[model samples]
Target: MRKRFVMLTSASAGALMLALAAPAMAAPEADTIVTFDVTAGSLDITAPAGPVDLGDGAPGSTITNQLGVVAVSDTRGGATSVWDATVYSTAFTNGALTIPVGAVSYWSGDSLPGSETGGGTFTPGQPTTDDQVPLTGTAITAIPAFSHSGGTGGSTASWNPTLVVRVPITAQLGTYTGTVTHQVA
Candidate 1:
């Protein structure tokens, strides 16, 4: 009985020693990196597609017309975006007959009904008829500098201008055509 007991104790002690000496099972893990990119935007402008026609008037009279809608779009997604719109005109001519560019006047009346949108400060070059400026061969500010202060994404502004042409008393009796150009920067 003693010998049997001694053998049983030896087997139990060997099993306990093996369990303690074995390596423990561990959880495995790995690391991964993540990434992405963002592209830049731009600023643009647009003008009326149709021609602006000032109705006919007798010699030594003035003809006036609306210059349609002109718009500026700033899509640069900038917090402090600024832009200016300039305008110039060529001499009105009918063959040899010419009407001087200085005789043309421009008035940036106001923004069209519900045409002004987004957030920014829009200032017309000519705020009123009294403030009309003479149109010369050289470009002048049609829409003065616009400053985007409290806005997000993009901003836009649009306005209708008035054109006044004074006919000289000695002007010829024919249709006079001139080109008016608008640019933004």
Candidate 2:
């Protein structure tokens, strides 16, 4: 699976790059080139932070649901795989990045991240909304927790989706971001 990163900043773009180019009056430029060893890490997907009760209707029709995978499993057998995917929104502030209460579906309260469902050739790490895939983008990454076999041992494969939600920009400002977290449970 291929991986890509997208960071949207109100700044001219590439906020990090501009910060590095800015002058530091108290510092002097040196003709020395320095190199250091570093470690890299993948983006973290925290758990959905909180819940936004969609609320009830005037006649008192209540609406209560949190966004999460409906289920994770196979066609014939396997442990039900579950993912604690979180969705949140952030806004740029002179004060630093901030997190805000995100919007949920009017009905499902599911964050409007994204979803795709159906049968087709899958490209791991190739981002898609196939709701039929696993919570993780890579098929190999998502394993069947439990499995069953006939006395003769013949089990079919199963598929689900890697449900996703985009963090809303309207989210509040803070050092971190959060949103309503709920499970299909």
Candidate 3:
């Protein structure tokens, strides 16, 4: 009976030791992970529909323009934003994106008090000042503007504006490209 009792006690002790040592076993192995995201994109600004029919009256004549969505956002209420607009020329890959080639015969204010064909009415993509380009001067006459939303509930702000440019027919006779840039401060 004593021998059986000792055997039971030893077995019980062994079982207890194993139960306490189980947690000390090291985990199988470690793992590795990697991640990535996207930002910035190429923009395509089209001369909005109702493009001046090339043969209706005069191709690229009596010109001025207004491009909508002057700017865009990727995230909801993102602090940073992108602005865009299309011009008569599809590509202004000129050393810069905007060019100067003519004289501004007239200037128009923002408030449009008359009809679309009236004077003093702001043409979003035309010169706002009646500027003249000298034989040795720049030709970009008007500069447009960009309005960026601050946040979900904040007032928006205007970014770099477009330069009003004059393109006198007598200046050149071929398709010309222009470019201008705006850096946020």
Order candidates by lDDT, high to low: 1, 3, 2
Between 1 and 3, whose lDDT is larger?
1
Query: Could you say which candidate leads in lDDT?
Result: 1
lDDT of 2 at 80: 30
Tens digits of lDDT, candidate 3, 1-185? 99999999999999999999887778899888978764444322222243222121122344343322222222322243333222222222234432343321222223232322211112333334443112112223223322222232122221112223344333334444432222221
Could you give candidate 1's per-residue lDDT for residues 1-185 as a string of tens digits? 99999999999999999999999977697778878654547767677766656789989999988877778787776666567777888899999999998888988766666765667666778878898877868564343422234566567778878888889998989999888877777
Per-model TM-score versus the true fold: 0.71, 0.19, 0.28
CA displacement after TM-score superposition, residue 156 of candidate 1 (Å):
0.6
What lDDT would each prediction earn against the true structure? 0.76, 0.29, 0.32
- Local distance difference test, candidate 1: 0.76
TM accuracy, model 1: 0.71
Give the winner by lDDT: 1 or 2: 1
Worst 10 residues of 1 by lDDT: 140-149
TM-score, candidate 2, is: 0.19
